[model samples]
Target: MQGIATQLKETPEGQISLTDPDARSMATYGKGTGLVGYNVQTAVDTVTHLIVAHDVTNIVHDRAQLAPMAKMAKAALQAESLNAIAD
Candidate 1:
């Protein structure tokens, strides 16, 4: 375990997850509340409420996912343009 510890020490984030290498620590609503997992992003049609596109990433939040997901959904549907909405 010393080698793993040493590698983690050298990393800029200083985070190491043994259970799942691809997962990361993510923040939640309450103070000191967090979870370790991948973030799942999905785009759906409002009328049909059917999933159009999806992506799994290790990013901690959804702030940066809107445009990329919209583009993906657009490509999936072969649309000329897309109007995306997020909360």
Candidate 2:
């Protein structure tokens, strides 16, 4: 990532403020045109709240985040399978 950051800094690419400079930035899913950041989702257990699996995505609409969020939650919980409901 250092190499990529150095290259981006040396080029004409625009920059956006990220939570971490070393974190990977991906184009988020939406109708917008041009460069955008992705909104990643993660889920954890009720007891431990430890992150299991995470999805790297650029979904701008909260509406579409449900299944992915639930899936991540299930993975974290290590359940054979589960159902998720989001509002």
Best by lDDT: 1
lDDT of 2 by residue, 1-87 (tens): 896677678644445345554343454466544444666666655566676666765444567777778876776676898756454
lDDT of candidate 1 over 27-53, digit per residue (tens): 888899889988999999887789999
* Model 1 C-alpha lDDT versus the unseen true structure: 0.89
Give stretches of model 1 more than 4 Å off: none
TM-score of 2: 0.44
Candidate 2's C-alpha runs over 4 A off are: 1-35, 81-87
Q: Which ten residues in a row have the lowest lDDT in candidate 1?
A: 9-18
Worst 10 residues of 2 by lDDT: 16-25
Q: Deviation in angstroms for 37 in model 1? A: 0.5
